[model samples]
Target: MTRRRTHLRTTPRGTLRAVTGLFLALTLVLTATGCGGDDSSAAASGDGKGTITFGYTADYSGAAALAVAEKQGLWKKTGLEPELQVFTNGPLQVQALRSGDLEFGYLGPGALWLPASGKASIVSVNMLGLADRVIARPDTGIHEPADLKGRKVAVAEGTSGEMILNLALREAGLKPDDVTKVAMDASTVVTAFSSGQVDAAATWYPLIDTIKERVPDLVEVSETKDYYPKLTFPNVFVTRPELARENPELVKKVVGVLKESGDWIAKNPEESEKITADFLGLPADRLTGSTKHVKILPSSELTRLSQDGTVGGWFDRLADIFVEMNKLPEPGKSTDYYLSDLYASAGRTDRT
Candidate 1:
């Protein structure tokens, strides 16, 4: 539960060079059509006056904390009429966004990369801080990251949870091949680990809490710190590029509302916890610990996180990791290719 500090260095020279080339190419594409052209009229609006279909997916029945956030009408409080969907995993939620069935939703850091590079023009508008944890049962004998070698680890394939495991392995001076990875859903990871099916499990809250409740002597190994300093800022709010350009104002409103709701949560933790627990159908007592760990960074923090290539730099590093792990097709351009205007608009200094 200790906070890990990350020092953000300036973007590496090679990354900057590649970003420069990509920026020029993008500029050429934009200039050919006239630089100052505005597509505001082409954008979609809400139902007549103030209703829009914001989309969201979570294992509401399973992951109580996320479910609580959704069921509490936090998005609605943020002026978004979210059309909620339930998905078992992050990859499936990203797929829903790619198909255009949903315009925007929460996603993992890894899920944002490929779609942004390919057919889906996704932009990370807000970042929900690290909500995942890595836990090992007492019987498994995994006292630390180094203990994971040759042991069975259950992870849901293509999730930020799985990606965290990969990053942790590298941090521990091991490789993915060094352990036995058993792919399983979030609900089953703990049970699988308890039954000796796997030595450890990489999963998020509720599950981690559940496992710890069942196995009190379970060892806590490397967590978000083991990965990119701050758990790679796993849960992020993302939208498609076309949607953002067409309706920048709406996007701005959505972000503004989320910021307000997050602020409210920060001020009224006990009430917020009650709302979350009731919505997720979990005991209010269990809510205190889980909610305390969920850090909702302010919109200003999100703005700084996106600016000066911090977000881009992280993506580049993630891409390199993906390639090294052989998880992606190839490393893609991180700067010019990803959208930043939403954060720019959200943090606009001159609103007049």
Candidate 2:
């Protein structure tokens, strides 16, 4: 089960495949799916022990913290064997998470909404800010939000980027039908916008930074914050209820690993960037926006965010947005499913 960590080349098309190889520290890769008890809270390794299948979508930097933690030897120290099953997006990971394949998943708030509806619970928050955005060419004369009307917007289908684009339109007093929707992958947005293939596009960090670099006339039209102040993509650490309850020790340890990883990222950024870039298969310079814009909250901050209602409050807002957007049937209460209790208990949990 403990296969070596091998570096997989990122394809231009952005299709995901199961990866295998080994890193300097303890790293394992696997492609197996068998673990959940359909819509139950016991979505964890049966005895709170054994190899953990971690489902991840690494196309975005928000989920890179897991790679950082692994490279830094945090998972090994926690006595937990983490076998990461690579994924292309949250929906794919959610499918794996629901079928009892993934014990842990890292995703943005928009993606997290799907699993939260199930037995999954988001335990910690990380990488929140202006990571994703709407970019357009200045020549389009789209200087203001209102100008987006009648524009051809390239938004990746089935992604947080699209969700943000819709929200941005709603904030601009525009409807989804106001503009021409050119469905594409997030990776293609940059070329689509620059080549005039689309007048505008919704994309994330490295691409956001890239367009600014490649096209000087590029104007970042909007982001998560411009529409809704509380609406930013936060990579919430989600798990099944039982994982947080039965495996408090493991949960706390994983949180500790994340805190250590964040600390390492902040302190040794230059080196951290190199490692992350290698793992993500992007240029080190391309990752600059990620470290600059994303806030990798440590366990301490997560505890505070939980205690102060920030985590729950943010989730509540997202749920409302989804409902209003007609993406969900109804808005669900945060307390009903969110295991903010995990963050509350992470600090006091007996880790022995």
Q: Each model's TM-score?
A: 0.68, 0.75
Inter-residue clash pairs, candidate 1 = none
Candidate 1 C-alpha lDDT tens digits along 41-138 = 22256321233433332222123333334545444443344334333334554555667655555554545555535545445434343556667878
Q: Give the poorly placed runs of model 2, Cα more than 4 Å off.
A: 1-49, 59-63, 209-214, 225-229, 245-249, 278-289, 324-326, 348-352
Per-residue alpha-carbon lDDT of candidate 2 for residues 1-352, written as tens digits (9 for 90 to 100): 2222222333323222111111211122222222332322332444434466666654434446666776766666555666665554455565666777677776655565675465577766756756667778878988766898999998775456766777777778998889998977665777787778888887766567667776777887887666433556666667666666677666766666666676666667567767765665555664454466565555666677777777777777777666655556777787766666655665321233
Best by TM-score: 2
RMSD to native for every prediction?
A: 13.5, 6.1
Give the winner by lDDT: 2
